[model samples]
Target: MSAVPAGSPVRTGAVVPVLASAGITVALMQTLVIPVIPELPRLLNASAGATAWAITATLLAAAVATPIMGRLGDMYGKRRMLLISIGLLVAGSIVAALSSSLVPLIVGRALQGFAAGVIPLGISIMRDELPSDRLGTATAQMSASLGVGGALGLPAAALLAENISWHALFWVSAGLGVIILGLVLRFVPESSVRSGGRFDVLGGVGLSFGLISLLLAISQGADWGWTSAPTLGLFAVAVVTILAWGWWERRTSEPLVDLRTTARPQVLLTNLASMVFGFAMFAMSLVVPQLLQMPKATGFGLGQSMLASGLVMGPSGLVMLLTAPLSAKISAARGPKATLMLGAIVVAAGYGVGSILMGSVWEIVLVSLLIGAGIGLAYGAMPALIMSAVPVSETAAANSFNTLMRSIGTSVSSAVAGVILANLTINLGTHTLPSQTGFRTVLIIGAAAALVALAIAACIPTRSPTPTPPATPASAEAPATA
Candidate 1:
């Protein structure tokens, strides 16, 4: 594996769009089943608890697979791993579309989750292939694709679920995946940059177990009793496994993740900032839709249909896409640290405003746009920060780890919001709903999380010094050393 010549000619117009489109296609998996969640028990002829696995399986699989796929991409080829990931997504969609029961649906969702590595891999590809002039906006667009797909998927999925069979959702996903796969094969070049090494099998297993235990506890703690044996047991296992995994990583010759490199202040602080920003960003996704769909009798509720709520939220995704260029400009001019801090401030302000303006649909849309802009700026800057701090060979792995941090943050955010909403519910004719106070409390927490991210970002170096590769046998196998 050797580095692509820096001077290799790239068709920027074709490469960027293909990669970004692929990224969006992968991201659409996250929200693809949301519209069918409430109806899952009836549709699948299973308990709600079993049906929830359809969503949980995806989250757990994604968390476990992201870092592993990234390492594989580095060792083999980014484009190859990327293609495999997209293939899994397509296969998953087809399986899900064809499934008539809960078990196969969960399996398909888990397979779909394997595509989580696509965005980070796309960013790495951009770094390897794009000219410096095009890199910033290109990565920005790729990063924003996550939000773009998620926001857009909600409305699209809602329309399909409303008008046709719920299975149509997966069928459409499979169709889109096929189209994206073809475009990727045609347009995206395999990066010559590679970190050739044996995969760390034990390290990967350790990480997967730890992450699975931790996320399972967080995501399911609300439904399971918070203090139940299962929740506590999973949390304990996660802590012990992660601690032991860290010990192993520190000593392993060719570790899965180079903990030494990750411990660098620039990398460490940027990752910390990413986590809190993820926490802040997810609050809107959890809160606004509920506010929209709650019955009008709830006083603050707007009483909108799921489709209408999705339509209102839809603009926020477009805002993210539209702001990518602006985010890139800010990062290029002031450094990614500044861009991240600015984004945090904007998000905090958005939440602050949202805490006050829960009265109407238009106000919710305004809040959604504000937060989306902030998340767009923050998300766009993260890859720049991570790539700047890590060696080229470690690019995908570092970015994937950063993404895992954000995922952890969102899981925790969901747990915390669930607890608050559950505890502070108002009764409305045999139904329990989150009170205005609960929503406001969640908004305030979101604002506080954004400020915490800003504080963490402030600690990141204004410019990361070029990192030296970790002292491992694998370092010699990297294109830089080769």
Candidate 2:
């Protein structure tokens, strides 16, 4: 529980690159399977609906794993948990690579999902190990890795799929996991920090079940008919479980999540805005690739290949990486609140571009870059905002919770956007595709989400810019005489 001695050496160079690489590796898993998704039914010898479970399984597993592993990292050692997460990624990739059927593939993908905890854990490590002055920049680049990995994954996977066996995709993932796991072991240090409390097994289980029920309902609601009994039942279960989880967390001394800390104005509002940001961020990813690949016969569709779609989205990821350092500087100079609000405005402007210019590849690329830069700025500042408000011991848990809020937002966006596009489809001879109006409506909603977040950020009570009291001046804590 004690801090490292003031002058103890901190290895800034090695830690930053290693943790950032680990983050990008884990994030790449989310998009790795995308390239092989359409052919899954044939590849795995399953019905279309059954094959879709590959995606759903990852979502459900990630939803459950992130919060639980985060608390584990706080209680035990961050590096230890980081290694475990990477191990799962490697094992999962191997399982998926060797599988010839749907069941193993889904199971493997879920295991990969368990590794989603890596990013938050990595962020926590940076907090514990980095110098105070270097903290902002390191965390910003670490956070931006989420977007970078996803953007890169698409094109890389698309290239493999086009040129090689679909199984090669999982093999690549496995190889990357192995290499990164080795680097993490070599470079990342175990923190002396520990909460030294009993694990809240009950709280963890309740939260897992609650998140599963909630995400299942959201992800499956469109396919099952939103009003179906199963969907409604899961939604009910989710609400009851979460409410009960909250009640239990309030009373448990060594709770998995400290509810009192999370309820503060700065933390609470930041989490709320993160949810809206997640919703807004996902709208573009959901819309853009589809817009690019849709048959040109639909007129508005660009009719690009899947590889081309991924290629176009690649620059967005680069911009996110390039913007992270600037975001960190802004947060350091002004405040994360100002940085977050700036991000929201930029994102709104990006959507504005999309609304007016949906015609060419170059135009779409520009819009995506703008939005990606906004996301980088916003993502980079979130951890700084959360860490400032909570005790140092709770950093991992707090960051984990914030990540969960974003996931929840993306889940909602998926369900809502899916329904909009599905219902507004136009039949073109042999196949159906989403209407131009559907795409426009989604963009409009995305812009609206960014603006809503901006307003929420504005409402967060800003701290008065208090000048520090003179160190030796008369005060209760200051000694009158030595």
Residue-level lDDT tens digits of model 2 in 247-268: 9999998999989878888889
Clashes of each: 0, 0
The best candidate by lDDT is: 1
- Assess the local accuracy of residue 178 in candidate 1 as a C-alpha lDDT between 0 and 100: 90
Q: Show the lowest summed lDDT stretch of 10 residues, model 1.
A: 464-473
> How many pairs of residues collide in model 2?
0
Candidate 2 local accuracy as lDDT? Answer: 0.86
Over 76-128, each residue of candidate 1 has an lDDT whose tens digit, in order, gives 88889888999999999999999999989999999999899999999988887
